[model samples]
Target chain A: MKADTRSGTGDPMDGFDTTIHAPNRLRICALLDTAGEAEFAVVQEQLDVSASVLSKHVTVLMEAGYVEQRKAVRNTRQRVWLRLTPGGRQAYQAHLAALRAIVGP
Target chain B: METDEAIRPTPQQARATLAELERVQASTAALSATPWPRWFATVLTLYIAAIPPVYGGMTASTQWLLPKSAWSTVLVLATAGYLALFAFAAATWRKKTGVALRLDVLPKRATLPLAIGLPALLIGAVVAFRSTGQPAWLFAASGIGAAVSIAFHRAFVRLHRKTA
Candidate 1:
């Protein structure tokens, strides 16, 4: 995993985060960014991906320090909830900015 | 070896990625906009409306309407019932939409004021009623609280639609 050195200043490309650029990871960030915190199963359903596949992407994001998970019991079952860390949120936003810059108006 | 040029997305690819992001956002927004259960709104409104009178009765020096003992029971029951209902609503909403109910999603500017103001308004009414021995203050506050509750619910729904 590469270090995410997204300096808030400088060219938009400086903020482009490779860790979050993968399509599945990008979609996960978008959903968590909007929803705040989502159950792991919920996220898997939204992405229409297998649990193992979603878990793999989530592990990559977690290793990058872009996402965190919470474990809790709900309805007599253990559940995992995922949310973006503040650093993660900042990187995601910056990545979006970089994408917009590339796309232009 | 993959060069920087090979790694970075071209403008066309960026555009497509952005479009996909927009689609994800739209779908998530739509899911989040799932309407609150009708009973949830009605019960919440009634709970808000009941607060002032219940507190007023609890604090009244003279037994204004109900005995102090009864007021205590009402207070306990109402609070417990409202909390249970709130938990049920949140759980059901999550089950239905795959999105958790989140206060942080609400605009902070609007939510902060309501968070502070609603309690202040309701408690203030109780205090005023206590000092003056007037039930009218309680009734007035109840009406205002109920109206505010309804208005906030509608605003939340509107916000979800607009975001979607």
Candidate 2:
């Protein structure tokens, strides 16, 4: 498929970012965009993916500055929470719009 | 003949990926809706139902059915219990949902009606109370409040299911 030349800013197809195009990463962003924040175990459970697989995808998103993590103590146990940053949300939404554009308006 | 082997998405592949994303998002929304908010609304409806009987001050004949002191005590305890239940429900909701609840995921079309309709119902309650000098009018208000809360909750759940 030919890459659309219209810039991602003006035309969503133009903004197709490679970093967020991976299947797991896309799923992570989609979930985070809706949940706002979710515990690591919860995300893994929902995705039905192994913790290692989730961790790898999360690392990729985090490296791209699209995802953020926080730590909290719950029930006397330390837990990690994940959420999309504002930038990540924008990127993910744009990617969705780009997908729609490709699919047909 | 050799074929180009580098993996790339065709428009059909892009469309399929988009559909899968939509399916995942829909599932996320369904899971995100949780039951906590509905439970909270149910308890709130009960609390609202208690308001008229407790606060409107019983009629003279009605007061004669139970000693005023005992009646007031029961009302106070019931009110306290309802409030405690609300707090418990809210906390459980927060924990069970795995995050702070996000009503923002609900379509604006779904929320806009609730935002407008609830206050409208309350205002109508006030109008009814003012127009008719009957304190019993409050019971109707409480009933409507409870019903509306439940309806709004159901509407949200239904919308989530339909969209999903």
Candidate 3:
């Protein structure tokens, strides 16, 4: 799909790139992007955040319909598996576009 | 296809958006300076396999000549050294791979091999640990260690075979 050339202020950056922002969120997305799918604990460990903090942020994005979190059992243990939803991927790309715009070609 | 309602940012908005792009690119670059896996299993293979023999030697060696205190101290020191080396190797591998050491994050699909593996390893460890200073324990440990590596090898192959 083609990208919208608009920004939060309804102005065209002309060549804006979209990228997901927020330090922890960006890190989480980066890990997920590379790792394919990872357990919640893996993301938490990589981000070095406590469970509650991750849960909070994850839930926020999750509620926004950005990230996908699934429940599964591994090694007979319950695991919270995470991946980026298509919507989330789009949002990330859009954010990345915005970031690219900020850098100006 | 282009949607009619797709928003078009004003030049100023586009310029501001460019700033976002800059920040993310830099952040991602900093986040992953190197690509690494959760567990760097390569370097661990050495002491990991060597453990059977080392532990076996400690158990079976004829200690009648040396003082009990000195032998025990030596054994402890050797084990400590092994651990230190393991740590060093792990660190180096991490630096090289840009991946963190994460054993728990192993693929859920790999549980079968792991399930098949843990028993084999446990039996080997039990046999080795239970041996009454017998050479047989070393052999048992060796066999178990081999089987475990084979199982782990299968897992690694499965993971590595996936196309990027």
DockQ of 1: 0.41
Off by over 4 Å in 2: A1-9, B1-8, B37-39, B50-87, B105-110, B155-164
Score candidate 3 by lDDT.
0.55
Model 3 misplaced stretches (Cα beyond 4 Å):
A1-105, B1-43, B52-78, B109-134, B150-154, B161-163
Q: Write the per-residue lDDT of candidate 1 for residues B1-164, one digit (tens) a residue.
A: 01144567989999999889888877777677666877899999999999999999999979978998899899999999999999989888886666767666567888899899999999999999989998999999999999998988888788778866
| Candidate 3 displacement at residue A90 in angstroms | 19
Candidate ranking under lDDT, highest first, comes to: 1, 2, 3
Q: What TM-score does chain B get in every candidate?
A: 0.87, 0.61, 0.45
| DockQ-sorted candidate list, best first | 2, 1, 3
Question: Taking the tens digit of each residue's C-alpha lDDT, what string does model 2 give over B3-65?
Answer: 122433677988899788777777777767765465567777776665554444433234434
Between the candidate structures 1 and 2, which one is better when assessed by TM-score?
1
Interface RMSD of every candidate? 3.7, 6.6, 7.2
- Clashing residue pairs in candidate 1 are none
Fnat measured on candidate 1: 0.56
- Cα lDDT tens digits, model 3, B57-90, are 4444455335546555665776687678668765
